[model samples]
Target chain A: MSTAVDTSAAVPLPAEGDGTPLKKRLRRAERRRNLLFGALILPLALVVLVAFIWPIGSLLTIGVDNPEIHDNLPRTLAVLEDWNGSAPPDEAAFRALADELAAAKGSPAIAAIAKRLNRENAGYRSLVMKTARKLPLDAAVPAREALVAIDAQWGELATWQAIHRAGGALTPFYLLAAIDRAIDADGDIVAAPEDERIYVDVLLRTFWMSLIVTVCCLALGFPVAYLMASLSTRHSNMLMIFVLLPFWTSVLVRVAAWIVLLQNEGLVNRLLMWLGLTDSPLQLLFNRFGVYVAMVHILLPFMVLPLYSVMKGISPVYMRAALSLGCPPFRSFWKIYFPQTLPGIGAGGLLVFIMCMGYYITPALLGGPKEQMLSYFIAFYTNQTINWGMAAALSAVLLAATLLLYMVYARYLGPTRVKYMKAR
Target chain B: MLQPYASPVERAWYFGMRGLVGLILAFLFLPILVIVPLSFNADSFLMYPMSGFSLRWYEEFATSPAWRQALMNSLIVSPLATLLAMVLGTLASIGLVRADFPGKALLTAVLISPMVVPVVVIGVAMYIFFAPLGLTGSYTGLVLAHAILGVPFVVTTVTATLQGFDFNLVRAASSLGANPVTTFFRVTLPMVAPGIISGGLFAFATSFDEVVVTLFLASPEQATLPRQMFAGIRENISPTIAAVATILIVLSTLMLMTLEWLRRRAERMRGARR
Candidate 1:
């Protein structure tokens, strides 16, 4: 193909009287086409940049954003600027804190500052709130003495250190907290308390659950894909509807179906009782079991579709040839057929795994608190706790994992795998 | 079919494989099918031994203000989002196919990133981004977010259709004294209409069924059907959700059938031209 193109280029076209001018006109026309195409794509490119890329980029930056502390406590931060780590902050720092608290009393910024401080030390929220509430603005005594009287926590070295650490415009607090590590009182990174060490476990659980779901999907999807591929085209087409039907159905409805089926009095439990399998209904819903069931059901088609597409392309001739050479059927199938389907398996497995890692609704509705994945925590922080920084940090982690998997898929299996999935 | 030269053991293996496949298919279909019958049950509880068949849950769904409002919201949002997605996605796809440009691959990746990114991530990011702009809990916000999610589908379907399109037809029309706009309307649009319509259908369905974003961004007034159902399932499992699910399932089945029909027609048209 390259030689043919080269020869054609070398031969050149039959020249007219004004060949150079005509060539220039062709080049201009090519440029015009390029410009038109760029013009057409401009709207979509802008929309994606504004709506998708910009928002995500901003959200990820929240991981290091620490404006609430620095903005609200400028005076306190300034007074503590010269304090060393040898002991508690001086009277001047406490005096600055009391004055800032009095000046900013009843302000929303104070509350925001309190929330930020609370994330660093467990009881600092109440301390800040209490100090700001009872600050003696009209007292004759020093502002430091008034603040210390209001709350002795103001005299603690650790409290001053937390405020000092949060003084920076950009802090690693949220990101560190996301991985279940935090800055200790002496400015060293250490593991969070035993009970607070939940994010790492949740992240691990997210990976483990996604892995299990992917494996389950593969186990259940392989035979079905094989059957679809080996069957007559007419039969395969009929069977394909079953796969496509669920694929087209809303994921929520499918999850709702699982809820109904797996509930204590629902179909699965009732069937178990009817068959004399157990004395009581099992604790199926609101647990890992329920999460696995629903996620596997929802993601099975993602696995099967790719596997079937790849399997469909594999000819039966190779397996037959191996069997005709006196190779046993199972051995021939394993060595000859399975190797040909690896691309499909890789595509499907990666797709399912990535999807399961980020799943929220099914697990949220069906799983217990402990069974929830990292996405659930991200939502929890975003909606319930109203912790945007923590939410963004968690999201950054999820986004990283997803992008890494996508990069691998694009690099190895090629972008066609993604395009093929979309086509289905 | 199994070869005649195969041993009995091989035949048994084939039968076993078929049996396993059949069971797996059953597993896939059973849960979805169960909801259909359970939706009609007179009892409110999702349990066995139906008391009798009635449409009480369906009636409740229709009469309840929340469910009705949610349905209305979904009806309002999906079409608007679908229209926006169709316009943007179709134009982008046409340009992508017609011209070669630097960073085209990167641009395609970015446009399709919404589909690949986790909905939770998108939801949180949009929530934070929209809060200050006052887009959260508004119709415009939901429509825009849903449109972004839907664009990739439209782009994919339209690009596929255009791949088989002959650009010479447009040139032929222009050479024959027709304007470019007229050539597009009279020639190009007719050929790609199926893809556009089906892509629109997908966009509409995606918006209609989306929940996580709605949960984060929608106000009480803008709550969509899936959002309402999610609340229902989370707070309480009732037959009303079943009725809603049943309706949605039937609606999706119809959409799937329409898409399949469109695909077959498109194939036949392409074949005839060949």
Candidate 2:
């Protein structure tokens, strides 16, 4: 703001600076205006950069973060740095482990290191805890035999291997495991054991479930959008409330409503029983079928809105001319109308698919545990297990997939249309 | 999409497509409307074949301390978050529209990234990021998180409004010896007020409906209505949640109507000027 800005006289006055030339003052004024606007933008820009983007960038790196072991067990890892993977390190490495565990015995770092090692090999938590609990070994006695005397696991090759594997300042453990792979005791990457090989399947299932929902949305949304676009503005506006109402409604409310409607004794089952479609109330809720129904219902509007806009922009003249030239109706519709709506289909499908890949609440509520998506697992790790690294690893994958799909959608819709107004 | 010609197949197809569209529309409306009656059901179970009509569920929502607290939390958090989002979003959008910069596209993408990023990712990110700062489970954290989520909508809407704005008016006022601040207050704000209000409404609705982040961030003491409803849906499907959903449905309807009215009024104003 300038001192001259307070004036509201009818006639224009000279520029503010007295000595300087008018041209230079005008240039200075332009610079000041630029600075003012930049100042106006700075607060929100700084807030987003610090509070949003930086945090997310740091979080994604947490997938590979290995601070716990690196900070806590620095001596043991340093001793083992020169050792080969096939066999255990010698007495000095054992001495370092003993000293480090003794120092970190009662601190939270021991528990953290123990947790980190336990991921390398099961039962290592209790081994490390027991050794840490009985630490500060006698200097006269050899560290190897003394540790072996404390816990028989210290004599085993696997214990040393687990310690060696977890000693890195930054490890690919969580990120690798997110895709159902892990480093073996011998420091070779291998497929996770059959029982632990769940995340890859989970990732695939997330994609598969998202694909099914996207296809279902297109199938259901196509006719609705077509009709809505084809209708008069008055009728279309009335129909719009149907789409927008559910669109604006909270996902939780819709989930609750779907549960009330699809539960065993609920309306869908009751109607099915009354109509003799089934002999009994079907197992609807907490099943894949219910998840599909609810997800399609919730996501139908996303598909419809974009498709409706695209279809509305398509003139009827093209199809009419094709038909007027003696082309069959179905052929004309397929060759002309369908091709024109391809961009809409791509945009809506990508948008819906991207959304479905990250869906948590609906599937967690309506579907069984087996049917939950990647987001469900991310939440499970964060809330139930408090495994931030694992959660972040899963998040990194989902975030990448989501951003990649968004880029594709943006390519289809262009930059300005990237604004998705779907309520969180 | 029908022709007045000549075959049973075409007629069947015409009726079939229309009927399919009708059923799809009904499908969209059914889940939303079905819960309204259950909110008033006297029975404990959330099922069909209502036993009786009663306002007990609504009464429960009105009286239960948890429900009351959640409603209060929603009412308090959303408006504050909306106000913050509106102010910051209005300022950033004005700056964006008024200035030219080399990194403008990058800045916009960064700003709008919150919308495209999944809520679960944002929720987890907020949890981990806020926990050490003692912001998780606090009102300040929740409000900031929600305000961030709302900024993109405000930017998009305000930017749209500013697109049709006449810059010559500002120049005219300034040349008449009015200061920039006076010109802005006397000319620009009144014109863009509608866009700000609509965007603020969106921000409010978003914060009111948000639950995923709250589940990670909010304590029981800070639970909003959607968080409470999520817990109800997870633990048990009860009539009380139905009542809450009904109220939320009504609220969303009112919001939609307001947005529609705003859209029409903006259109009418522009039409009048034209």
Candidate 3:
């Protein structure tokens, strides 16, 4: 570096005739500054790429990733390629299946195949496991007869269709299943059975719950935000602490607080019973009501923060002008005041709605089995069930929704508005 | 304040609005207030009407190995993650402010994506990506994941501070006898110190309160305080969790107070300069 600087100085001294030496040095310094800037950003850029972007991209690919069957049962997959789904697998396919299963014995690959196939059909796991156990690779009997004798499912065309569908290097199984739709026997997308149609309802429930929470926040937050905006700075700052206190509180602690207050014999019920509002202790926790109460409580600050900022900016002269012109107070408020606050409404409503959609801990603690949202299932698949494909598919849906909302926010309300809201 | 030219109905509406706002504020603050007393309940149950006041729950939290380990892990992780976030985020913010390069918006968006993207998605993705490299359940993986999450806060705070900063001071220092590093330390660092410290506080809070990524990434040994609270709440509603929650509430209150103080200091410094 010192040698380069010295050389540059040497060359620039001679080039003083063509340009000023100071100009040349300044140009070199600017170039070096840009290079330093790039160098400074490189570590963070690489970290985001490796730790944030790449993982999310790869996780989204899990929906279409069907390497389990494709990589495991290669011989069977190849042989079954020629055999159409119209009939049971031919003898050659059976022999290929037997070879692959025998080869995959005492290995994790067979279990992978079984798990993949079982996702398509319930009994396919036992069928494959049983068939592999009964028929050895070196069995003298014909492959078709041995497999059919070992399990009747081997003779069914649906079983072959499922295996064929699961055979490809990439499949839409998980993405379809995530929305409670699936490829049927004829390889057509169809709605899953009533019992199997869970994810769609859960997704809808997630949206519905978020919408309710957003509306609740708006209804409850608007007046408070207005009050804060209208109050003296000293009084407003005192009130702002109340709002920011909960905002800064740990989410788990807040959820725990709700549980302590809303349980059967908890404070809320006790108060209600004492006030003669109810004869019996109300069931509040682990229900939809509990979920709503806790979610709205947790999310109200989010709504109020943006609304307060926007309200603080709104001028009172417009309302006074409308009132002087004999417009009713309510009408002036509805027409002049509310229209200007739409940006804040849009910002806070979208922010809260998107946040509510991705909420896991609050809903999981307060909501019951039927009240759980898409995030709950995402966690369930990732942790408890270890179903990466479904987890990824659900996460993709959530990411798409969040990004879409973010884009809308960026386009209309501006990203800085959201940033300021967060920082405040 | 209401206008003097008002009807009786308008007066009624003003009082009603005040009442409603008061109720909403109560709704926001009540739940947080309720937990402080419950944490000292002598009985294990978290119901209303405490059997007796006792420090047993706090004692349990202090004595129990699980709780202590979670607290220790959180202390270790939050500070390291905060430091990493401060360095990377501050550097990136400086580069962003100084250089007018193409795709700068895209780079900024990518840096902030961890903050906006659903935590569940990030957790699942990080788990899958790290699992193959055997990074899951390890402190290195958790810290890296957390540092990524912490970057956006640091970037935002520092950038906000930089918006009011004068870059000519940097040029003035360089044109004088100072090198870039010395100029940065002597001139720029003092101005941005409040921002850096507040950003670090934000990073610390994020890492401390974070549970979703920790759930997906941390093993039993690496269970963070929030993760432990989540388990305790899920498995059993114990007063120990209430005690932990109380401690966290106090910690966050302190952090929030510090952040507020920093903001005021920054404002005063800016005001003094003006």
Q: RMSDs, each prediction?
A: 4.9, 3.3, 3.7
TM-score of chain A of each: 0.84, 0.87, 0.86
Candidate 3 lDDT over A1-424, as tens digits, reads 1122222333433344556687777777667666666566889999999888999999999978999889988888888877766888678998988888888877888889888899888888888788777657546788888888787788888888888888888888888888888887777999977887888888899999999999999999889888899899889988988888888888889999998899888889989999999999988989999999998988888898899999999999999999999998889999999999998899899888888888888888898898888888998998898888889889988889889988998789875345433310
| Candidate 1 lDDT, A327-419, residue by residue in tens | 987789899999999988999999988888888998888898888898899999998988888999999989999989988987787644354
Candidate 1 chain B superposition, TM-score: 0.95
lDDT of 3: 0.85
Q: Which residues of candidate 2, in runs, are more than 4 Å off? A: A1-31, A79-94, A141-162, A415-420, B1-14, B176-182
Which is the winner by TM-score between candidate 2 and candidate 3?
2
Q: Which candidate is the best by DockQ?
A: 2
**Model 3: lDDT of residue B86:** 97
Clash list (residue pairs), candidate 1: none
Docking class of 1: acceptable
Instruction: Give lDDT per model, in order.
Output: 0.84, 0.85, 0.85
Superposed model 3: Cα runs more than 4 Å off: A1-15, A18-32, A76-97, A118-127, A134-163, A420-424, B2-7, B42-48, B51-53
Listed in order, the DockQ scores are 0.48, 0.58, 0.56
Model 1, residue B138: C-alpha shift (Å) = 1.3
